[model samples]
Target: MLRALGLAVLLAATTIAAAPSASAVTRTAVGGGTGIIFRLKPTPETPTSYYICTLTAVGRDSAGNLVGLTNAHCFIDEQGNKLVGERVYRDTSPAGTAFSPAPIADSRPDLETGAIGTVTYVSTPNNLLNSGPKGLDYAVIKLDESRVAPTSTVGQVTITSIGAPPANGTRMCKEGHRTGLTCGKKLGTNGIWFTHLIWTDGGDSGSPVVSGQTLVGNAWGAQHSSPILSIIDAMNTQGGVGAGFHLAT
Candidate 1:
């Protein structure tokens, strides 16, 4: 089995590298309630390296293309470099045996349901140092609708609306492929740096953070993020209007 603590440390130390651009394609947007764990494999290398992360948010860009959200660190490696044309795969079974041909009960990403996503947008690590810090540590992945099931279809979960940023002691919860339905009180201001007092481990990165039914933020390193609105604003300014990505409702 993979060690969460070790993997967590490696993720923190890794940085992203530039990837060759691919022809732009329209992605099918998905709504919240998608808590599938997926694997990311960097390409053009002889030996493949894999990282596990969760799908936090799903939606379409301005052009009505489907997209998903995750953490930028998922695309980074210990070498402090990023991979170009990275491919994402859905976990067809339990976290420990996702690649196995055998199946488990309630195991997702089976023949009928699986998702393939390509890394699209990721927040710059420099945000922590920039004069105007945005507290962003997120990424967006464009999904292939034909292969992946929407959140509404797989589970009745949906991120209908985005709630205000979290404040200290605010109650929040997260759904992850590795750990399902863990909730706790937040530890910081709603619009500032905040960490939930929830239980989170390595693969939980990219899981959605929520307060009640409202969307809050995607999991950072393990359980952290800038304000939820701050991340959205960064996407607007950096991702531009064409990205057209937003929380549902």
Candidate 2:
């Protein structure tokens, strides 16, 4: 829903039952900085739609379910609506597949990596909550054990723990799928965003905002960020899909 976000689309409602992905490789790491796919089908007989976004962090919930984080916008539509049955896949695009108006001709349903997670909890313009992204826009993804090898590192940045929002003038960095690794100073405010000046773009949604090894903020759009520490508190308070989350190390 933000200006810097990209939307990857592939709609094939006619395809019944996705075949098992023979090409679905076991990802050594599906934590922060990884590229992921979100798929949705209006009905069993309708076409499935897929979108692309970046994974922020992966670990487990209080229930011990393997889970990850990203922006809720990735699973929502232009009208600020969420697809009821969105499923997540490991995006294998070498160049990154940020969403645009038209579906990428090659961006077919990539069951190749299999479905790794489903959106367990989310916050978007359509469904903002007391624990939602109004304070920090984010989504909680429950990862499938079969499709991922969990780790805490986002690219080269190791997320050892959650941290407070960086001071306005503090230094920060992010590992985005589209922008790769970029760093800048904590700049703006007046909004829930940490407001870093780092280089961000579409498809970089949910990229990890880190201060050294401490996970701090989450990239909201191309230019805005939200506090990961705040999101964790919100998720736990919601007592839903991602309640009681812990970062995997």
Candidate 3:
């Protein structure tokens, strides 16, 4: 199982105080929350395999269907619209090693290929580049529960409810496929921004941002080594306004 690495030096910019106590949860090493993201092609032809981001968590739609939360950019095409009806796969390993294991003959048997999911809903494309009035960079993928469950590899995360936008210096952390878990204080005021101490990579987008086991937001974009997260309320707002849905706690 992959464990999270700390990036202490990166958070020097912010003064994070002792955080409020949070509850605990349990999870497995693989096939849980926070996994490799992939964009499966629609055609019968060979699917283009590429690492995009992390599948933040297993969510439930308003209709009670299982779903996966991720960044809208992960499912968007060049034209800007989130790719709907696309087959996506969230592999167990952060490095996507589950897709291709060692020993060519053992690859098929060793890899967990049942992590297939579909893009069900995404917030409308808006000025997500900046902290606009709307935060619309999240997407939901209806997961095939036969494979992926509502759990995390590092540990189980009991998301009781969406949290308010974090204030500056509010201690928080996130678990990403590429960087694992990293903690820092909130920095930006325009939107939700964590201190530069928390690390992220190309495949770390869509990761879950939390504070003491509570859901805060999802990784949207980043700059200067600091990851930008969409406010949970904004995500909830978009989910309702765009898809008539609510964020699954």
Candidate 4:
């Protein structure tokens, strides 16, 4: 039997309070869940480098194609440095055995455990001046076809159709690399404005926030004013208040 990896101790020094707080929410089974964990591997010349991130399995886009959603900030830094997309891995257990990008053909890692994926589309950060700063902090990535075979651990993801936000107090959930799986509830929503009180943390950024098959939002900024400041909704334009963009249907 394959064992899931144990939760790693979060680092206090780099931890962000804006993330959801820890909780005892029941963890759902992996295969039909909402999130997938991916680890970015550094090249031999960059052995000291490390990169890991999470993604939400949003429904299909406008064209009816499957798409995975995540925060654009998760892929790059404020300085425009690529933070994701070198090579990624998913752990099979806490023992460190992982399914990473294979070095050659025919020797590929088993997909039933987990397989590698690639960063397909990364959105440019448009400052509020263009549309307002709260715009969608989201991006779309394409999993490697061979790695994403029917039997792969990171199964196909679906992009949600745009629609009205979920009612207040509705249940929500997310899958993340660091936290594994967690659940929460909707606190409020108005137009593109949304706020949720999920139990996520650092490495939890870029996680997709979903309500059922609908892609509600992505984890972007945390409230600095509250105990667990809520996740702010991405504005439509760069600066104006509106809902973030989803895969065009």
Best by lDDT: 2
lDDT of 4 by residue, 1-249 (tens): 000111112121221112122242222222222233343222212122333344544333333334455555556543566544534333332211113321111111122433344455554432323343443445555444333332113322233433444787887655444454455777775334466766555444455555665545555434100111122222223222112324433
Off by over 4 Å in 4: 1-46, 58-66, 81-115, 124-132, 150-164, 189-193, 212-215, 221-249
lDDT of 2 by residue, 1-249 (tens): 463554665554455456455564645557788877665445322336556678888888888888888887776776667654567766655533223222233334345456677787767531222344454668888777766778776556778888887778888988876666878898867465667777777667788989888888788664678788778888888886678888765
lDDT of 1 by residue, 62-96 (tens): 76656777666666555645443456656444443
Best first by TM-score, ranked = 2, 1, 3, 4
lDDT of 3 at 125: 36
Query: How many clashes does each candidate structure show, in the order listed?
Result: 11, 10, 5, 26
Worst 10 residues of 2 by lDDT: 97-106
Q: Where does candidate 2 clash, by residue pair?
A: 6-99, 7-99, 8-99, 12-47, 12-48, 13-46, 13-47, 24-112, 133-136, 133-137
Candidate 2: C-alpha lDDT: 0.69
Question: How big is the positional error of residue 148 in model 3, measured in Å on the Cα after superposition?
Answer: 2.8
Give Cα-based local distance difference scores for all models.
0.54, 0.69, 0.47, 0.38
Q: In angstroms, how far off is 197's CA in candidate 3?
A: 5.1
Every model's TM-score: 0.68, 0.79, 0.63, 0.51
- Runs in model 1 with CA error above 4 Å? 1-49, 94-115, 126-135, 152-157, 190-192, 221-223, 240-242
Candidate of highest TM-score = 2
